[model samples]
Target: MGETIGYARVSTSGQKIETQALRLQEHGCSKVFQETYTGGSTTGRKALLGLLEYVREGDSVVVTKLDRLARSAMDLGQIASTLEDKKVDLVVLDQKIDTSSPAGKLMFNLIGAFAEFERDLIRERVQEGVNKAKEKGVQFGRKAKLTKQQLESLRNDFAEGELSKGQLAEKYGLSRSSVYRLVKSEH
Candidate 1:
């Protein structure tokens, strides 16, 4: 039989992974890889990459929770697929997910679908909220670069041909496109 390898992760330095490491050790994990990096970010994930390279067939990967392994269902699915390809088992302690059984595989699939659906709903709600706020005249994003008086002067300068769009942009410390947009708004 192969050994059980554990992985523990915490999102920030302020958080501790000691609890998770202890849990994995108690749960029969001989080796544990711990890291303090955001699960969503793949860059600089040295521990995870090392674990993936080190595991072999008959070895099982254990984690305190599914979120400790991945940020999204798509990412989870991809990681699960890689483990399956190498004939390695995945055990998520908190979620009670073990890929060694048929039922576990089914549950993982369902969870992935639900996760994706939840993200989509959140995005839709946010977009709707932004639209409603716009209707209420609540502007979002950065404030305008040029105020009303400056825009009026810019329009006058452009109309009088005293300066070109490029010259106006340089004088006002704005982009040429901004100068064009301000001039167009007057007509």
Candidate 2:
């Protein structure tokens, strides 16, 4: 039998990993990796990255729940594929999923498919809401730093060559890049 490693994660510092860690220990995990990360993507999760690097062929990775392992079905599929390629087993305690068994693998795939479908539905709904808001004249993105009158005045001042771009930016309480962008927009 290979070594069993554990991973414990909480989305925020306010949450605790003690419960998950204890459960992993009781489940015979020799070492437990822990992290507190709020990002939906796993790119910035240091502990998870480290755990993935440390596990070798025949080793097993255990997590209390699937959500602790990944935020989305695509992410879960990627992680699971990585483990599969490395010849490592994945065990999700709450879901009773063990990739070492055929039935467990099937169950994991089904869950991932459902999760992906749900995410797609949510995305479609959000896009529809955004479209409706736009139709109602709701503006998105950052507000313009300068009004039309201010832009015209700035353009005229630049055309007159009385002051440099830096001077104009200082007078308008804007950056040199902003001044350049505004001046360029006029053309």
Candidate 3:
């Protein structure tokens, strides 16, 4: 028999990992690693990396949910492969996936496929909504930081050559690149 390890993650500082930790503990996790950070990429997941490194043969890595461990199906596959290579088991409580058995592996693959399908459907729906919004004359993304009057003033200032680009940027609380763009644009 080996130790049972648990991992918990919350995307932002505002969210708490206590509930996850408690669940893992109740589920017989001898050790739990918790972190608050975005799972957008695995590059900066220190706690997860630590747990992976610390696990040994016969150990089990547990999570409250499958999504809590990896951002994408590919990521989950890689992590599962690593755990398998290390002779460690993966247990996702919510999904009831325990990679210690043949049936579990089959279920995991099926669930991954379904998750990818769901994501593709969501992306298609979002694109359709965005296209419809564009047809209705809706705008997206952040509004320009500089106002039309400020842009015009910057154009005049640049034409008069009263202030340098840096000075103008400082005066208007804008970046030098923004000032340059405003000055260069046709009035």
* Clash count, one per candidate: 0, 0, 0
Ranking by lDDT: 2, 3, 1
Give the distance in Å from residue 20's predicted Cα in candidate 3 to where it truly belongs: 0.8
- Which candidate, 2 or 3, would have the higher TM-score against the true structure? 3
Q: Which candidate comes out best when scored by lDDT?
A: 2
TM-scores vs. true structure, each candidate: 0.66, 0.80, 0.87
Worst 10 residues of 3 by lDDT: 111-120
- What is the C-alpha lDDT profile of model 3 across 1-187, one tens digit per residue? 9999999999998998999999999999999999997765667899999998999999999999877887667877878888999999989899999989999888887787677677678879999999999999999998987788977877888889989999999989999988877777776
Order by TM-score, highest first: 3, 2, 1
Q: On residues 49-152, what C-alpha lDDT tens digit does candidate 1 reach at each position?
A: 88888899999999988778876778778888889998999998888989899999988777767766776798799999999999999988999888888888
As for candidate 1, its clashing pairs are none
In candidate 2, stretches whose alpha carbon ends up further than 4 angstroms from where it belongs are 9-28, 35-46, 71-74
Off by over 4 Å in 3: 185-187
Least accurate 10 contiguous residues by lDDT in model 1: 111-120
> What do the candidate models score in CA lDDT, each in turn?
0.87, 0.91, 0.88
Per-residue lDDT tens digits for candidate 2, residues 1-187, read: 7899999999989999999999999999999999999637889899999999999999999999887888688789899999999999999999999999999999988876776677679889999999999999999999977777888889899899999999999988899999888888734
Error of 3 at 155 (Å): 1.1
